[model samples]
Target: MLAHVTVTGRVQGVGFRYSAQQQAAQHNLTGWVQNKADGSVELKVEGPEQKVDRFLEEMKAGFTQFIKVKQIDVDRFNKDEGYKQFSIK
Candidate 1:
């Protein structure tokens, strides 16, 4: 399964991408996480349903500068999301 998550708030420049990469790697997820020009973090992760869900949780509640996570837009997608090994872009 695949999921695309857009996390908004003070998520950029606070090791969010690296943190996400670590979490994704732990789950053996393949995808990418990027910093949007608007300051949100965009992530596309493909893996087991449970692990992906956990990734989403970590994105929202994990140690991200200890700032409030304002919004998270999650989209379930088919298998062709196009990615390999979590990355930051």
Candidate 2:
């Protein structure tokens, strides 16, 4: 499955992308995380459903101190981007 996640709050310049990369690697997920122009963090992840869910949970729970995660918008990704590994983009 593929998901596009937009995380809002104090998510930039707080190691959120790096933490997300680590979590994605741990879950064997392939995708990319990037800071948006609007001060949000955007993530595109593709992997097993359970792994993807776990990765998201880990990111939210582990970075609570640095990130508030005010809002999270998750959507289905239809394109076949074929990401090989998780990355900070």
Candidate 3:
């Protein structure tokens, strides 16, 4: 499955992307996370269904702490499904 998470907030820096990479790696997920020009971080994670759930949980885990997740738009497993490993794109 593929899960695309677009998080908005003060998520550009403060180790958000790195932490996301860590979380994704921990779940053995794949895809990427990148700092958007609009001061948000967009992440794409692909893995097993259970792992994807955990991935989302892990993603929201740091919200309002390391970063404020004002908004989240998730597109769940609608398309691609072949990501080797997570990355910062």
TM-score of each: 0.88, 0.88, 0.87
lDDT scores of the candidates, listed in order: 0.83, 0.84, 0.80
Question: How would you encode candidate 1's per-residue C-alpha lDDT over 1-89 as one tens digit per residue?
Answer: 89988889878777888888988998889899899999888988998899898888877785565645789999997675667688888
Candidate 2 residue 38 C-alpha distance from true site, Å: 0.8
- TM-score of model 3 relative to the true fold? 0.87
lDDT-wise, the better of 2 and 3 is 2
* Count of clashes in candidate 1: 0
**Model 3: lDDT to the true structure:** 0.80
Quickly count the clashes in candidate 2.
0
Residue pair clashes in candidate 2: none
lDDT tens per residue, model 2, 1-89: 89899998888878889888887888889999999999999999999888888777776674648766778888975554799999988
**Colliding residue pairs in candidate 1:** none
